[model samples]
Target: MNEADALVDGEPQFWGGCEIALNTEPLEVIKEILKACGGRLFEIGGVYKLYVGAPGLPVLTMDDGVLRADEAETAKPIRPLDERVNYISGSYTRPEDGWITRVGPPRFDASRISADGRVGADLDVPVVQSGKHFQRLQQQLLNNAAKERRHNLPLPPSAWGVEPGDVLQWTSEHNGYEDKLFEVEHVTDDHSLDSVAAVLEIDHDDYDFDPETDLIEEPDGVLDVDRPAPKEVGSFAVAGVANVGTNNTVRPAVSVSWDDPDDADVTAIRVAYRIAGQVDEPGYAFSYEPAAGQLLIVNLQPATNYEVKAQFESFNGWATETTPWLPVVTPDIRFSQNDFNAAVNARMAQLDTASQAAIATVRDALVNDLTNLAHYLLGQIAKLDDQDQAYQATQGAAVNVVSEEVVTEKQARAAAIQSVEAALDDAAASLIGQIAEVDDKHNALATLFGQVFAENGEGAASALFRLIAHAAPTGVAARIALEAKTAAGAYGEDSAALFLDVIAGVGSVATIKATAFRVQTATGFAPILEVQDDTVKIAGNIGVQGDALVDGSVTASKIAANAVTAEKIAAGAVQAGNIAAGAITANKIQAGTITADRIVTNGITQSDADSGSASGAANGTWRTLCTINIEKDSGTRGVMFLGIISGSLGGSTSQSAADIEGRILRGTSSALFQTSVVATIATGGAFTIPMSVGFRPGSVPNGNHTIRLQVRASIPGGVTIAASGYLYSMLPRA
Candidate 1:
């Protein structure tokens, strides 16, 4: 136990380092110091020592007495164990040849050995070529065989020193255990200062009696040398399984999650999947990194159930325990097909709804248009009827006038008839033009209707509507125009006939005059036929009708001078040739009866005179005495303005006499007449001066001409002119 005894009794070791000092008493620091000295502090054979240069090998014999499994000291009853199977069958691929080599027998189940003489479980490991891989397969198969029949040996408090990884030899004559090897796998330490004892749990191990190689036989009694020690087999678990999605063809996605373990030796995670009932067939196997525990399996059959398992691989390419199988199912393809059909039907329904809405809108607008057009046509027809009535009234008036008047009184009536005819012609032409305009409008409306409805699909309905809408106005305008024309023609004919009757009546009057002349010339009597009594007159109506009179039949040579009188002449029958120059003198003619139209050559004269006196007392300033506007006819020959100014100069003396001046101006021209008179009068005396001014504004345009009389006087006192002024203009013939 001392340092010098530990060095003499224990083995000597060499540690290359310099001597150093430490000032800590902690157990960790003591252990670190010893470890730095190339040694470890350990207890062996009830003695503690710092030993180096590797530990002693474990002894694997029953007579050594360091560890033993005695049945009498056991705390639990022993059970009979099943024998483990030997011989493994698997296939491996040689990387150089790319060929699979199968080793061992196919069928080797020990459970069936009693029935069919099969001795071991024929386990299969596929695609294993490397020596390390083969060794892993062999160890896994042996572990499986050992696990089938495991023995749990419990040790009492007396064996409290026994620890895990320690090998023990069991010796018991009654339970048929002689020289069987077991390793302590677990131990329960209950031996505190007050506790009674501890318990040791052990599992069977294949071991050997050799002093150098500590090998063991398998459970089925096959002594295999160089067997690997039992290792703690740990596996990553499949924590979660999920179905991500599926395609239209029913291909599914599956993802799995597992623990990473965080072991540097762990390289990857392995996944295997198959249909639920088809485990015998070859399934899918995939490998992924250990950090990524998820896997996705695709292209699975539709509506099919599946199972999956996951495991992890070590850096040595050895697989650990696999997770329990998980169940999944691929989606059905019919669901997707139903969804697609629903979408298509929904879209079609939307389009149909939109189309029906559009059709309804168009139909409503078309109906409104038709209603408006119908109303318009009715209005036009009403207007045409009014025009027709007006035309009829005009025609009736023209016709009545023609039928009521007599031809003997038609001399004055003839001119009235001509005027009426002219008016009727103008009215008829206007009515006709209006009717034509209506016809054009109707045609335009029809064309518009055709164009508007032609674009619609309802052709028959549109055509019927067009015809119905236009028929009334078209007929009404045409009928009115026809009636107006007929009335106009009748009125014209009646008027012409009436005019001829008047002409004939004038001829009859001439004949009557000629007969009188002939009677007077033949009998040499003043009266052709004298009446003796007042009642000696014809009772029947007298009528004189003829078309013409002979040229010399009614001459003066055939009649008495006073026989032909005013009463015998027709109103419009007398011409210039029928009267002598002096026959109708001015005194004999009626006053104002000869208008300007009857006097063709003599132009008109307008004259005005004023007699009021006007005076201006201021010197050297003109005063307008009077103003007159003379209307000169077009082609007026001359204008004359005359004034007789009479006034007295109040302050006229010999030294300073008063001078008065007068002037006449036309329009804006210079003085047409200017005169000045100087007189000397001590006491105011009257002076009279006559002024005459005339202008021949040659060929004066038709307008009113103005004349003004103005006078100015010298200083001290001014002269005044009595308003005896006259302005006149005479228009001569052009």
Candidate 2:
């Protein structure tokens, strides 16, 4: 305890710099006051640590012990910026905001800091830090954070989906095949899409598509009407997709059948399609009924192919043209609505269970018309009350000495409550005139069985088995064998029962002609590709590899690059991504492009600095980036996300417009990446932008960046406006 006589009895006798109080408490009296004082603790955040200790006092608060001053530089002391010693201090068990208040010695408020002599020029660095500089910075940050969560996991097998967004191209022979589009903001429970699983926002340069694993995928370019078609029909059938259907009048019905020496009467049936070598557009060829010397037909796009020759009418009249045969797409059968709803709801819940059983057989024939409409509106409101002695002892009782069957059971319970309020006003006026035919029969059976199997056409999966047997009056092959699945691709693990976040993995091949590519690199879930085995499947979620995920249910704390990881979700939760919908806030969060690996949520209120990484995103203080749940002027806004987030939070590299949410809530794209980090954008607050864009087609892509608004100020400023159709500026850039 005589550490230099406790630093000369804790020095006080004022004046000429002679004091000593290095009681950092121990570690050999703070290594004899850091071998007598120079400096260390470079930087940290959230709590406290400014000890350049021994530089004769800057400020000390050890939870309030005392000694301070640096009032910006109180009388030329000039010292507090060697990495400012790290102190953001908002506290979550202290991340660094410690050493409360201190400015830098009014000559040490009458002196003290020195216990083992020397206290000032003690520099030789190395007071403690080395188990290999923190075990190689925690194994290079957990292997670059599992390679940055498999490099932003949007899943095109974790290589990232092809940049910007929106893609629906098609063509095979005359070139063109396209179909299966979906994305109206990542489905909001497509009838509980049978326990969700599909997320695709991808684009880390689309991993150069090398994919493989087989589904049929072979074809590739050329077929100006059978120039060399036939891609994978031999090795014995079962692997399909030719493309085109609905209204270009049909050609995608291929299955021509040859070897006919006696199957009689049919001539001229040979063909081969799927062209457009690496694309240049125009892949044309027509003829649904016009023929003569050679009607090779055209217009084949969206993944391609063409092969033709149809001129055999015969009844002994004179027709014979046979020479074009070569269409693909054979892979059929797909069933897997969670393994066919666990084998048709385990055989329809062992022959029955979500039990409403038609609301218990129409509530036992409307239980005496709902107990005679509640005794005819409680006896017509107990005949305008007033006699209320419990309706005067069963009221108006004078039926044959006490019972003509209780006066005909109160007139058949007041005529069965006026015939159950006239059968609930005639079944709500026949379901409000079939509410636009039940939204056109669930949008015409989920869009005519999704356009008969979304084009890999053979009359598009027999036109979706003839429009689900002309729109299910009964069962239509148990919901298309529970949304069929055989060629193998779609899957889910439990992203809160999934709509996205298997946390992320996307695969699609859909071919008309030009093929080859099933997904290569970043492989995790057992690499498998080749596709085209009658493609047309796409179903539910699809984040494509904007950066691999499949980990939802949030809980992650700090891991940045783009964002989102802390998953679990459910308190106003509605993520989406790729395009946008980011709003997870108790303090703050705004997602759209955090890429994905684990952002899920389930009621997380914990704020130990939200739990870690992404650089404490500034302790998320009031974290509002793009808020728009559903009512800006009124309020409840959940799962919302407007748009138009132009850009800028004051890094001022210039390029400023910033909007983010004029009105989004239409389902949100993973909370629109937290409106990207709205540096200072305020136009009407609660995040606003989206001016209604319509341009998606092959033009505005390549990550479509934005940032130039350099105004600098100094007398070069002006502001102009016209409003209406458009014309706004802040002039003075001469």
Candidate 3:
């Protein structure tokens, strides 16, 4: 057991080793059906640790898989992964016949990085590759890697003579240091230190600096260390295989299914899958909530055996139990481009869809809590008010102010007993965490929310509220004091949740997010509202804030509060119920459908006075209420009408036969619409389309909306009915 015995290990265990003649059966014939991608078929009953070679490249059975080693035993015409596909990826070595040639030396990256604490990136990514082929191949691979930025190693760290990023390394006994296994830091003077080294990275942090931090350590000393040879849990087979490709690296994979018998207390299931037959790769760790009982395997090399194991971790008991599962046999796959793209795209989309809805939902939840908070504040104040009055009358009316002060001074302490009578900010955060524990996904978000930008916002709001809360007078001032606390709490809960929701929602997670943002003016900048209560202003117009939705009739960037009309509407159909609900308001009233006992049409003008137009009447320049705006001038501008259509601003512009447009029609009311033509088409800074149509008070005949126009002038080339049309609703009975 000296030098000769030291050269070998594992008791010369051979499971699938033999020299079978090449042909078409259990020899070369059987291999044709047995060889798998990134692997060769080993003899079914004879071998383990066999030596072999595919043309141009040796398809080494460094471990096991190849059934035989005889050249005659190699299969005939089996499809293999293209070697080109493995070039930069180092996925597979390809045979001369376009089959994936077997690859050895997974530790090749070790050579460039272990010389002198320096990773030699300057070392060319070596290959037997030709210049022309490599150039085209490298570019494509680069693009692929670029698209997968998540997988890209961090850009090398920037520093003087060193870096703190991913560097290739290997463990090997160097320079007869008594078999001290040192991490390869760099290749010194182009010398290969050993024929059997495995890659590893340096991970030591030396803190004590003897001379103000410049104690020079030799290169070999920095990495020098002894480690026993790594043990190999030799090749095994996986059972019940499923999906792969969760990662970009090529590896063996198999499906696994198991359950925690004690389901009520479990929190998560952790799985580790790793490729075998290599000395360099590390296994991956993936954890899933107990909720995802099943997981799909991915990133596997076809026909390779991947070792997989799952551990169930329980939240209730804080214990983890492991389960042993079978190995998988990766099958040879030749996928069509379209099929591949389609499958991967669907997988990626699945990752994005759920998150898209989550943001809006969490936002709505915050808003709901805020609203509830207001309701709670009202309840607490009423209770406090009643208490104050009861004590005042019962004790002495003379002590009203003093007694009130005493009550409030004691309120926070007293309220702390009942349901935390803190300010709004505190109340809101309490609710978010309170709600999170109700759902698993919600709780996970809460955990992530805490770890990421800590709800410092809530903390900040609480801080601000406490400042205001503590500053108030003790007695009568307490009521006002508490409100500030409540408001602060509300802001904290709202702002923090909103911030996190926003980041998580972006980046393909959320499809749509709507928020009402108030504009804050920069210091020294003053904005004035020219139109009082204006909802929309010109794009460049200076104002307090812009609209969250689309611009209305104006191109203005901001809108002044309460300026827009209640009569104005967007895409939705205006309903009769809305009139009673207080949403409907107009300067004049014209009853449409009389669904009630009677109808009241106050100041209803004759149909001839109305002018109703559609989108194209003025060639899309029309903005409803554009003319009602006094500041600007438009070609379609005219006198403002309410109860009914009105004639033009000019008396001479009216034509009795001009088409009259119908008013918006309500349910059960079809509207017959028509429009009056432009009295005259004017030049620069002006133009016009004077149109109108009307119906019986509540009976809009078409129930469909139309621009009923009366041509009073040249009526330039009559308009044609469009492919798509518009519809509307009549006014509710008044």
Clashing pairs in 1: 108-120, 109-120, 206-216, 207-215, 207-216, 208-215
What candidate 1 gets wrong by more than 4 Å, as runs, is 1-604, 653-658, 668-683, 697-702, 717-734
Per-residue lDDT for 62-127 in model 1, tens only? 332333334323443322233445445554333433344435323233554554343344433333
Pick the TM-score winner. 1
Arranged by TM-score, best first:
1, 3, 2
lDDT of 2 by residue, 1-734 (tens): 12212221133111111123565455544443332222223222233233321112111111111111211111111222331111111101111213222121111101213322222211221221211211222222222112110111112122222221222121212112122221111211223222111212222221111223111122222223322222221221112344343332233233333233231333333343444233333233332222222333333333334333223433343434434434444333233244444454444442233123322322343343334433444554465443433454665544236566655655654454444455444432221100101222233232111111121211112111111212344322212211222223231211111011111123322222223224332324332444455563332233344245555533345334544333322222343554234444435654453444443332311101000011111112221223221111111111211122222122222323332112212233332222232222222111112222111112222221221111111111222111111101110110
TM-score of each: 0.18, 0.13, 0.15
- How well does candidate 1 score on lDDT at residue 67? 32
Give Cα distance to truth, residue 645, candidate 3, Å: 55
| Per-model CA lDDT versus the true structure | 0.42, 0.25, 0.31
Task: Between candidates 1 and 3, name the one with more favorable lDDT.
Answer: 1
Candidate 2 vs candidate 3: the lDDT winner is 3
